[model samples]
Target: MVTLKHDSHEHELNLTEVDAYMVGKGKCGVCEMQINEASSIYKCLREDCPNNSLSLFFFLHKSCAELPKQITHPHHPQHSLVLGREYNQEIVKLTRGSLPHLTACKLCSRQIDEQMWNYFCKACSYEFLLPTNAYLHIFTFSLCIRCAIMEPAIHHEGHKHHRLTLLRRQLSLICDACGITKENDFCYSCLPCQFWIHSSCAASPATIKLRFHQDDTLHLIYSVPHMYRSFTRHCQICKNEVLKDKWAYFCEDSGYFVHITCARTLLAYGENEIKHEAEEEEEDYAQPHPDLLQFPLPSTDSLVANLLAYHQLKNPSTITNPIAEEPVIQHWSHEHHPLVLSEKSTFKGDADSDDDENDDILICNGCTTPILNQHKYYQCIRCNYFLHISCANHLPIKFPAGKCLADPDHSLNLDKLEIKLGRNLSIAFCHSCHLPTNGFGYRCNSCSKLTDIICCLLPDKIKHDSHKHALVQHFNHPSFKMYQNICTACLAPVLDGFDYRCETCIDVQIHQHCAMLYPKSITHRFDSHTISLLYPPIYYKGIKYCEICELQVNPEAWLYWCRHCDQCFHPNCIRAWHNMKLGDKIFNGGIHRHKLTLVAIDKDRYPQRIHKSLACNQGHDNGSSLDVYLECAGCFFIL
Candidate 1:
């Protein structure tokens, strides 16, 4: 019991020392809590005090009337937590931690904004902001409502049959809701069901609409047992096996299925990353479109099925070689006609070669390898196509299945020949690189109609220091109208062969090998600093001229641009002035009779037979300020 005077009157009151139950329930005025119990209390002897309302009395607990000098929190191992008030701006600095922006609450996984007053721990770097009064309830369960979702078990919309148990230790299990192997420290598991899900995957949405399969909506299937168990499932988008034990999406009516990660990938990338099916189907395919060079190659199975059936009906003979004894057969690359085996001793050079038969010189058209009189070869006399013995037997007819350099999403298949009266088109050229070849060719079902074999076999990724972005190989850009295919680098027609194109920038194309040939560093006589290759020379307000040749260099063309010297040299000029040594023999194209040897001119002693300067038929001037000229030894014709 205690007594105190209030309003000049003496009164008696009851008071007792605080206990655990009392400490837990007593309301405090300062912290506005029903718990904290460190500060002393006094009871008034009088029944009431001035400014009292609703029988309420002034009470203090811990630092209610005053302020907490410091506080120690388990979450913060280093710095002491301190109370902050409106007036004590200096003491207000003792917050738990700081959050620069609105971030997710660790307990609830809900977003918390920066406007709220926060407690900061400098040592542990913990940020504790009172999001709402509800967060205080977390102290009882030793977790958040979100964390409590995994306590004994949690029922997610993704998984309805059984509740998922919280897995606190590192899990070696793979997530059933997504096909990714789990290496995470924590996840949810159904031990009896042998199913696991990532905490992230558990938070996935119920339904999704993917770009690839836009016609239908997909419903999430939480476990393999919940999926269509009657048939083996494969992802339609990625064409990969969907494990029966994994989570995936399925459209019941359409039978469309996709991987969880693949769907997320499309959603994350948005429409730009999606391959437009409508755009690919927009081609006005000619009836009986047998022009193998056309965009979008004809179906391989149909063409090959017809060709093989026709070949079987036409020729059934099995010719076996007596020596080495391998079956001599007709190959698809050579018109499906019988190619008689010719041994090294029987090779009579090439019929078209100007060299005498005894000269022992020939070239195999297949590999472009020189065939000496001693090497065995295969030749089609009717077509004049020669191939090395090995090339004829083992050359690939189609590219392997994968996303080609030309089209990122489409899988490439070889172009199938349409046999017309026992012969396929021999003059066929690769639509991408315009190079004529009777070798393996490729086409993508997704984007391209046809592509050259050489271009399809190119490495999918290449690194070049001059290029800022990793240039991806594109077979043929559909954006270009017919006859409008142009290489921005050389400013020439790029109807054939693939271009290493920038995925980020449209209209940026580089020749595959040309881009790879850019030098990392180069020393020039005119420039003091070592210059490096620049894929695209920076275009100033005015046109940039090549420092070496003085010709206006196309900004898109590769240049050896020096940052220190601020000079740009065309790639051709770099090779001509820096790489080419004096006395190098080179051809001057159709205007010369023989190869010309490069020579420096003695300005005073000009040859009588040679003109001072001459221009080629194409109107390109031969005169250069740096190097003199190449002249014919026989006629002294200046080239």
Candidate 2:
């Protein structure tokens, strides 16, 4: 007796191998394809079941019966794909923007039928379309039966010089046909020429006719012609610069060029005609009226009026804020009087002020940072409300869809973080920084996600001194699943919050605060000279040890170094000792009855006592004692 688990069956089926003649003419339960009379099949042997009268017999082809319940495909190697037959439309719609390619088979670039049994990552589907407050790392994948069982080795027309062999190892390389670097566990490669191509790219048609170019049929070309290299060319579909050395679909008659991946995406979606119509309508609508274009005399008022009219027609709430239009504007924090922008310092005394000595300093209410006298600021005439010019300008009325990283699919409006918090929740945390804030920030009313002003102003791409390549900010990228969530700079595990990752170096990732906010140079108590932030590739003769931590410092990792003192220190060590003082009292009820005073154990004086008493159960010691310990103040007992 054998148990068979099938998608259509509610219970496990007792099955036995039988000829097609014994099961009669029927389709295979797995593939839903016709079964041949000569082929062997697995048939349900449960004849005593209560549902037997309803004729609920299961039949599967011998090959289909041998299919693994779960598989790890090359396209999505982050998670194992389980065979399933359910396709929820609501889940697909929510994740369409992030995982647009999931609608089709990742290998063949063909649309997947919702009714057919396919392989999918169950974990990704569950959390892929979660709200912005939750992590948004989703890379849903679906593979049809045909693509899953494709031949391991084949002679592709794209690379006719050699027969490409399938390599089932995760690799990041530029596909020869698409000219795009994609990380995949499976790719056909010609080892001799180091040529690699995606399965979809290799199977792409030799020629394709797009609705946008109905008059011309684009033929796949290995390289751009020398005649076409006379001038700069861009892909007609993507509008990106086309490399003359890479393979692309080219039309010599109309001189049209399209990227292989872009062509495949358009063909799979079949949106070329709809996109063409939309583009045509947009072009016609963009043309200004003849009456309005006839006159050249126009002031900035006309532009503002036109914008107001457009916003009123589209969304009246968007243009209701008059602060953007006026120089002296009423702010949400200080609504008593309109704040006026000024270049000079405003030293108006506060209501509780008793002295003029501290008037030189001014704090911006927006970020709670001291505003420099040299920079412009916005100030209120009657109150202490003040804001830096940069902060004042940074607060946009609303961020349109796809503009803000907090919620790419939805528009976020500028609102008080406190207002967005639910009644049960007392605090609101920024999606980017993960810091609780009550100040002004962007909020998505739909998801109730808030992003602080500081995070909202962060740029999409940043060139950090630690890495040679520019690090792009990712909200919750799927690639993070492949590597540990450890920041390379600080060497700390960042379980949550946004990160800036280098696309070229997949492992090179840093926390957003570590990349932008850390000080370049600092004065440590242990070192006399200023310790500057040191990048990788230190040409030291021997292994360098941190002066503070007394541990080996990795030369390839970023650290704080004092060139004058010839000392190195880990960034974490310096941060730990920044505000630390000896004899600090700590209240830990679990360890002691009273407050404990922080004290250092001198290795030279009490080496044996420290080794015997303070060592772990295994009695392991490094024989270096700059170690700090807590002493109970009440009994004077070392802890």
Strongest candidate by lDDT: 2
Instruction: Candidate 2: give the clashing pairs.
Output: none
Residue 598 displacement (Å), model 1: 61
Off by over 4 Å in 2: 1-330, 336-364, 367-374, 378-386, 403-407, 419-425, 477-483, 519-531, 537-639
Instruction: Report the lDDT of model 1 for residue 616.
Output: 26
TM-score of 1: 0.27
lDDT per residue (tens digit) for residues 1-639 in model 2? 666676665656654545322322334566654334345566666666443433234567777777888988777779888876644444456656354465666655555555667787767754443666664444366777656765689997667889999875547888876778777435889999898987666765566554453445567787878755643456766656678877787766555677877776665442333143235456544444432211111211122233234334444444244445346767776666888886666444453544211222455655534444456678874555577654455345776776455457887787765422121213456776655554567777677677775565555565654555567877654345555665777656655567888787666788765665445676644667867887643435335677754667765457878989889887655543211123335665755578765554546434543645454333334465444456663564565
Off by over 4 Å in 1: 1-152, 155-163, 168-172, 181-186, 203-206, 209-215, 222-241, 262-292, 295-639
List model 1 lDDT by residue over 1-639, tens digit each: 553322211343234344322322223333233322333544332446542233233343322333334555444435664432222121134333242122332333333232222233333333334545332111111112223223445788766688897775556676667757756435877778887877657755456544343445567776544434543456655656678867787655455566777765555332212343224544522233332111111211122222223333433331211223244656656666766666653334453444211222334544332343445667666655565664455334444444354555566665532211111112344555554343445666776655543354344444334434456766665465566544545555554456676676565566653543334555545677977765432333334566755656554455668888778776545533111123335564555768875454423223332344442223434353222455675774664
* Clash number by candidate, in order: 20, 0
lDDT of 1 at 390: 47
Query: lDDT of each structure?
Result: 0.46, 0.58
